[model samples]
Target: MPKLWNETIAEHRRTVREATLETTAALVAEHGLASVTMSQIAKETGIGRATLYKYFPDVESILAAWHEGHVSAHLEHLTRIRDRAGTPGERLAAVLQAYADITHERPQHTEIAAVVHRGEHLAHAEQHLNALVRDLITDAAQAGDIRDDVAPAELASYCLHALGAAGSLPSKAAVHRLVAVTLAGLNLSPSTPDAAGGDD
Candidate 1:
């Protein structure tokens, strides 16, 4: 059809898809993932069943799309934080803290995770995350802020695994402490008593 008409139609479809994904996530969170249904999603999203089917084949596909969007948003958020004005060390610290907080704050939707976590998006996200942190580590190491003994990629992997513990941390304070410990491991010039004045 007309160009404007095509653009408008595309926008409308996006709106409908967004609404469906949001409604389905809420329903799954409130109820259980196993308990959610396409009919329920259609009703909650205020869209006809046929229209919902046009967007997603079933509840599983809808959840997968929602998860992919969620993961992409998270990656975008970290990119923004990394690009913000800061010294390499400062930006690295901020990124690590933000990542820890994200892990801590994410809801423990075990059922939904089991269904959606297996998608290729997870692998892509993991690669993106590793590269982002690896680049940050390289910058900070070059600046003499982070340790250079370990390879930046290896350090990035270590940070990812260490911070992953934040997901089960009891409180925000615990998460912060975990970040601090992780950062300490990366410190290039860890504090030590002056050899010339050990006892003053």
Candidate 2:
């Protein structure tokens, strides 16, 4: 194929795939994961059943793509939220709060959040997010913003744990309290709140 023709075909393919993902996401949002299906996606996407098969071999493949896309977007959102505040403490809090809100309310993300927070896959995703979060933690510790007794690696592990815990919290008020307490304890500065500041 000519270069222009190939580019056009690729763009169209991307468009189709995105449409399928959006439709699948909407169904997942409204009906939950148990009822999502390739047939339903095909119908929602207004594409032929064969075409859906050509793009994704099965519902699992669609789900894999769906998860990958959600992960990419979530990481980007984390980076953006991290950038929203200047200081490491500020950025860390913002990042956790943003992720808490997302994973708390968004079903697709909440499901993947659970999956990504466990096992080897968690490490796999951490490979992409670790450096970004490490720098934030290191900066805070150096500035006496977070506690120094814990090494950066342990602190980083706790940060991931914090995001997971916040998502698991029952209420928004409760989640915020947890993040605040965790943030204070993570702060190396002695002036910060006592370890027991937030409700357990």
Candidate 3:
């Protein structure tokens, strides 16, 4: 096949796949996980059942694909937030706040939890998130903005676990308060220079 023809076919397939994934997720969310079927996904996506099958074998597979995309997008977003210009402490705080916000705003459906929790993708994403926070903590400690008495990896784990509570919080204000408390736990010791913003 000509290069242009091959490119067009690839693009078309991508579009169909994305549409099917999106349609399946929406249908499942509306009708519940077990109630959604391949036919429903095809009809809602405006694609044929056969075409949908070429991309995904079952409703569970489609949900898994949709969740993979969602998790990948979230990781990319967190990476962008972490890479932005700021003091180590400031960037760390922003990333933690963004993470808490995402957790707080995520869908609370058990079906979603079921799909997202069973994949190796989740483990890999968790590792990436842990490293992102760990490195930030190390930098903040080096800059004297965060306490150095504890290991960075331990503090990173603590931050993640503590922020996980945001999912159950009743309000955004409460989420912010949670993040503030998590950050405060990393504060420098009172005897440290500039700990109280005193003059040199």
Candidate 4:
């Protein structure tokens, strides 16, 4: 086949696959995971059952793919926030705020969120996020904006754990408050302005 034809075919396949994943996720959200089926996804996606099967073996696989895509997008978003022009502390705060917003405004249903978070993609994403935060913390500490007594990795984990409460917050303000609290834990204290604060 001509290269142009091959590219077109690949693009078509990508479009179909994205549509299928989106439709499946929407159906699952609306009907609950257990109530969704392959046929329903096929119909909702406007694709034949066989065609849907070519992309995904079953609902679980489709959901997994969707979850992976979601996580990849989120990571990319965080990366952008991290790369923005700002002080290390400011950039870290922006990323933390964005993450907290994601939790506050979770797009997936409860069941889907639970299932997707249990997947390997989430574990890897968490690691990537942790590393990103750790780097930020290291920079901030070096700049004297954050406490440096403990390891950056340990502070990163603490930030993640503390900010996780954003998922249960009732409003965006509450999410921002949670991020503020999490960040405060890493901030240099006023009284001990020159003290390198971290767990010994």
Best by lDDT: 1
Candidate 3 per-residue C-alpha lDDT over 1-200 given as tens digits, one digit per residue, 9 for 90 to 100: 13334567878788788888888777878889888878888888887889788888888888888888888898899899999987888888878888998899988778877876898888999999999999999999999889999999999999999999999999988887788788889883333234432211
Q: What is the TM-score of each candidate against the true structure?
A: 0.87, 0.74, 0.87, 0.87
Off by over 4 Å in 1: 1-7, 188-200
TM-score of 2: 0.74
Query: lDDT of each model, Cα atoms only?
Result: 0.86, 0.70, 0.84, 0.81
Q: What's the CA error at residue 95 for candidate 4, in Å?
A: 1.0
Local accuracy of candidate 4 as per-residue lDDT tens digits, 23-67: 988888888999999998998887789988888899988888998
Error at 83, model 3, angstroms: 0.9
lDDT of 4 at 165: 88
Which of the predicted structures, 2 or 4, would earn the higher lDDT when compared with the native?
4
**How many pairs of residues collide in each model?**
0, 7, 0, 3
Model 2, span 1-200: residue lDDT tens: 13334567789788889888778767776776777888889988888899899998866556567667777788888888887746677676677667666766656365534533454544666676777777788887787677778787778778767767765678887776766666766853323457443321
Q: What TM-score would you give candidate 4 relative to the actual structure?
A: 0.87
Candidate 1, residues 160-197, lDDT tens digits: the string is: 99999999999988887788789899983322224421
